[model samples]
Target chain A: DVKVTQSSRYLVKRTGEKVFLECVQDMDHENMFWYRQDPGLGLRLIYFSYDVKMKEKGDIPEGYSVSREKKERFSLILESASTNQTSMYLCASSSGPIYEQYFGPGTRLTVT
Target chain B: DQQVKQNSPSLSVQEGRISILNCDYTNSMFDYFLWYKKYPAEGPTFLISISSIKDKNEDGRFTVFLNKSAKHLSLHIVPSQPGDSAVYFCAASRGARAGNMLTFGGGTRLMVKP
Candidate 1:
């Protein structure tokens, strides 16, 4: 079975603080994605990596950055956490360039 | 402009009835469409998907219908259970070369009541 794990289920950070959200997938999928879910907005993609050391900005890449140094791990970074950045963060992985993604239990981050 | 849109913000349905959630997309290049179910504080899960070549795809209680010409899709849940009460999001992808990047619609919240 495919398993995507995030470092924390909940996180709290102060404004302007640097925050890191980690995700690791055991499926060895070639594609990894980071998304933020908000009340009115659905899951908005922040960043995605198709392969190691490669990344692409998604629809809402404004307050986020991502890194994929190894095949199984992808990390999302918040350079300066803001109140608007507080939302449910999700990590997903897919074997190929398809939308059939296996998702991890999301991390709910609260930026104060 | 929003590429994909779920017009309905919420829907209330009675148990054992059919619940239909609608989504529309403006991108003609979208060849694959999918539906996902999400509960509060949990990640969305892949529900069902349909290819542009086909009009409909069914997976037990869930059926996804795609109208390529209309650039629309809908997900139908039969015998809607209380557990089905959650937010549903519809997504679209252009092709494989797009690196599986999915453009999601604003979710529709479904409330299934007994």
Candidate 2:
């Protein structure tokens, strides 16, 4: 079975603080994604990495960036956290043509 | 605009009955569809999937039916159990994309009563 692990399951930060959320996959998948899920909005992509050092912006990438320094790890960075950024963040990884992504336990972020 | 939509926000079913969750899409380019189940404080887990070429796919008690002409799909759970209660999301993807990034619908929350 494939396993995707997130660094934190719950986090709290003050406004204007910078936050980093890390994800690691044991399957060595080539593609990793970061998504924020909000009530009534579903899951919206924030950023995705196809390979090491390569990143692309998704539908909702504002105020957020990503890092993929290694194949197994992907990181999501919140440049300046705000109360609006408080939501459940999910990390997923997939490989090959089968687009079946394995997800990690989400990180629920609270910005006060 | 929401590409994928789940019109019903919540559903209730009795245990041992059938639970039907529906999803609709506006994009004709979507060639693959998937269903995911999620619990509170947890990430969504892949449930079942169907390609454009097939109308139905089944795994155990869960089956997915796709209507390409209507651009809609539904997941049916037979003999629903209490453990099956969760939020169900419908997602679609264009096969031509490199990673096939998925566009998801607003989820439907399912509650099963015993």
Candidate 3:
């Protein structure tokens, strides 16, 4: 079975603070993704990494950025956290294209 | 624009009954579809999937039916149980082998009453 773990299950930060959410997968997947889930809007992609040091902006990547220094780890960074950035952040990893993605439990961020 | 849509925001079903959750997509380019189940404060988990070539796929008590002509898909859960209560999301992908990126629906909250 594939295991995906996140650094934090819940976090609270003040405005303008720099926040980092970490995700790690054990299956050696090549793809990692970051998403934010909100009520009614569902899950929106923030950023994705196809390989080490490779990143691409998803639909809503303005306030977020990502890092993939290694294959097993992916990090999401908030340059300046705001109240609107408070949402459930999810991390997922897949071995290849169009494959099932294993997701972390999620990090519920609260920017006060 | 919302490419994938789940018109119903929520549904309730009694135990041992059938629960049908529907999804629709506006993009004709989509060739693959998937269903995911999510609990509160948890990430969505992959449930089942179907390709455009197949009209139906079944796993255990879950079955997904796809209508390519209408661009609609439905997930049916038989003998629904209380544990089945969760948010169900429908997602679509344009090219299955090219990339894993997917467009998701808003999701339908299903409550299975005991």
Candidate 4:
């Protein structure tokens, strides 16, 4: 079974503060993704990494960035935390395009 | 504009009954469709999937039916149990061109009453 683990389950940060959400997968999947879930908007992609040091912007990449320095780890950075950025952040990994992605438990971020 | 949409935001059904969740997509380029179930405080889990070439796929108590002409898909759960209650999301992908990227629907919350 693929296991994806996040650094935090819940986080609260003040406005303008820098925040980092980490995700690690044991399966060594080639693709990692970051998404934010909001009520009535479903899950919107923030950023995704296909390989180490390679990243692409998703539909909602504004105010968010990602890092994939290591094969098992992917980190999402919030440049300047804002109230609107507060949402349930999820990380997922998949071996390929057609394969099913495994997701972490998710981090509930609250920017005050 | 949202490419994928779940018209119904919520549905309630009695246990042991059938639950049908619907999803629609505007893009015809999508080659694969997926269903995910999410619980409170947890990430969504992959439930079932169907290829564009196929019309139906079944797994255990869950079945997915796709209508290519209408660009619509539906998930049917037989003998719906309370454990089946969750937020169900429908997603579509354009195969290799998208590189695992998927467009997801708003999701419908299903409540199975005991």
RMSD of 2: 0.8
What iRMS does model 3 reach?
1.7
Candidate achieving higher DockQ, 2 or 4: 2
Which 10 consecutive residues of model 4 chain B have the lowest summed lDDT? B93-102
Q: Any runs in candidate 3 off by more than 4 Å, and if so which? A: B96-98
Please provide, for model 1 over B1-114, each residue's C-alpha lDDT reduced to its tens digit, 9 standing for 90 to 100: 889999999999999999999999999998999999998867889999999999999999999999888899999999899999999999999787646799889899999999
lDDT of 3 by residue, A1-112 (tens): 9899999999999999999999999998988889899888888889888889999888899988888999999999999999999999999988886556778999999999
Give lDDT tens digits, candidate 2, residues A1-112.
Answer: 9999999999999999999999999997989999999887789989888888989889899999899999999999999999999999999999967778889999999999
TM-score of each: 0.96, 0.98, 0.97, 0.98
lDDT of 2 by residue, B21-91 (tens): 99999999999999999988788999999999999999999999999999999999998999999999999
- DockQ for every model, please: 0.73, 0.77, 0.67, 0.75
In model 1, pairs of residues that clash are: none
Q: Which regions of candidate 4 deviate over 4 angstroms? A: none
- Residue clash pairs of candidate 3: none
TM-score-best of 1 and 3: 3
lDDT for A56 (candidate 4): 95
Listing every candidate in turn, what is its Cα RMSD in Å to the true structure after a full C-alpha superposition? 1.1, 0.8, 1.1, 0.9
Chain B TM-score (model 2 vs. true structure): 0.98
Ranking by lDDT: 4, 2, 1, 3
Best prediction by DockQ: 2
List fnat per candidate, in order.
0.73, 0.63, 0.63, 0.75
Writing each residue's lDDT as its tens digit, candidate 3 over B1-114 gives: 899999999999999999999999999998889999998877889999999999999999999999999999999999899999999999988785333788889999999999
Q: Give the interface RMSD of each candidate.
A: 1.4, 0.9, 1.7, 1.4
- Report how far off residue B43 is in candidate 3 (Å): 1.8
